[model samples]
Target: MTINIVVGAAIIRDGRLLAAQRAEPAELAGGWEFPGGKVDSGESDEDALVRECHEELGVKVALGDRVGGDWPLSAGSVLRVWTAGLVEGEPRALEHLELRWLGRDELGTVGWLPGDLPVVEAIAAYLG
Candidate 1:
């Protein structure tokens, strides 16, 4: 079985979390998710995450804590997430349909993609 590795960022600023809305894949479109992508072969997860942030959000991020253990996803892929702080530039939804900052109490206003929902719980606790 081929296991795919995916990484995500829980970017927070001023006690607000950044959420990106998906713009592709008919099944996942319109869903909210953290802005990161696949870990390319030969690239460290950290490097992929940083590169993804720059590409997806047009910003640079300094990764902090890991959100949790590897999160299981459909098929054999697993998602690894980390808490991130913006190092430079404002977030832009370059690869997403939209970007929104949700405060501690507003995390549930948008429908999060299922694979990303568990991480949200961890984040909500941190936010509180």
Candidate 2:
């Protein structure tokens, strides 16, 4: 089986990370996750990330340093997580049902998609 590759973004501002809730349950449904989506055909991971950010959050992201990346679970899907700062545009939830800023303390408060837990830990490690 061909594993799906996804590019996820961890937008940090004022020490808080931006997370979005999936509209419904599927793999990580109802769980809070980084705002991103699968990389489309003919699109590089970086390009896909930029597009996903604009399409999902309505914000322009300057792909900062890559903080973390991994292929967790048996789906063979790879998760590329990056540290990005908002270049322009205010965040308006485009596809996600809701969005919120989560501080380190509140990070564990929300329900995270199973695959996201490792990504979250990586982010937490990078922040500190």
Q: What is the TM-score of each candidate against the true structure?
A: 0.97, 0.89
TM-score, model 2 to reference: 0.89
Off by over 4 Å in 2: 25-27, 126-128
Tens-digit per-residue lDDT, 102-121, candidate 1: 99899999999999999998
- Backbone clashes (count) for model 2: 0
Q: Over all chains combined, what TM-score does candidate 1 have?
A: 0.97
User: Residues 1-128, candidate 2, lDDT per residue (tens digit)?
Assistant: 87788888989988888989998657656678888889998898889999999999999998877755564744678788888889999889888878998888888988888877888877875453
Q: lDDT for each of the candidates?
A: 0.94, 0.83
Top candidate when judged by lDDT against the true structure: 1
Query: What shift in Å separates residue 115 of candidate 2 from its native position after superposition?
Result: 0.5
lDDT of 1: 0.94
